[model samples]
Target: MVFRTLFSVIVVFDIVSKQIIVIRDKLPYLKAIVQYKGELNKDYPDTYTWAKFLELGKSVEDSVVDNIIKEQKPGQCAVLIYTSGTTANPKGVMLSHDNLTWTTKALLDTIGSDKAEEVTKCTISYLPSTHISGMSSLAAG
Candidate 1:
């Protein structure tokens, strides 16, 4: 995945290339859109704005959502987090929903917080969202 930073917004690019490899290489990938501008760029066709994503979400039926939720399991992979490439290429760490929930519960217990909502309402988080530590804080709250 290629992430292009524009201001505080990050644009996800399907093809992580320096040039227009989509046309030259005939790569099979979707187009990219600039989220801030809410416009489709010729160079990036696979991207969609946040608004578009929300719109797509709104189109999903409640039954479909319920069905997906029912299919979810604690042992299933919830997220694939990429490690910081300090030595080699960044490696993806697969974390299950159970793992995150367990960590969250442990953190909350350690902090003596019975209600996550209360802590979340007052907490000011400054950690990077990409890191596990940041994820744990967010999940705990």
Candidate 2:
């Protein structure tokens, strides 16, 4: 009985540990994706027709792309988007996992990211993905 209890405890602990690691690693990626999407939606509403968005999303795998992918849990912070320094003292906008993930997946599905080879073939202008505009461009590329 003692051995069984210990085994059960270990299994539970292992599962919990794995969960934590997955969440820790993925939540940020998810947020990045969402933020990327939010930027896309905010800037290019007309470009992302429903059909185009779906085409972009289906083009690549989550693993192939480098990004955040986990949902944020209670008491967890997802992002700190702030105003540019020139404006009123830069204030941080805290976003949740839902805000980030949903936005990212939505945008990427519409816009699209691509490989160097793909870009070369398609005449894509390469840009970093951290900025909203850049991400959209990368997605398009």
Top-lDDT candidate index: 1
Write model 1 residue lDDT over 37-64, tens digit each, in one string. Answer: 4344443444465667568679899999
lDDT of 2 by residue, 1-141 (tens): 111111111111233333433444333322111111322333321233334445767878886554444443644555444444596665554556555555555655654534433543554445433334344444344
Model 1 regions more than 4 Å off: 1-43, 122-126
Could you tell me the lDDT of residue 46 within candidate 1?
A: 42
User: Using alpha carbons, what is the TM-score of model 1?
Assistant: 0.64
Clashes of 2: 15
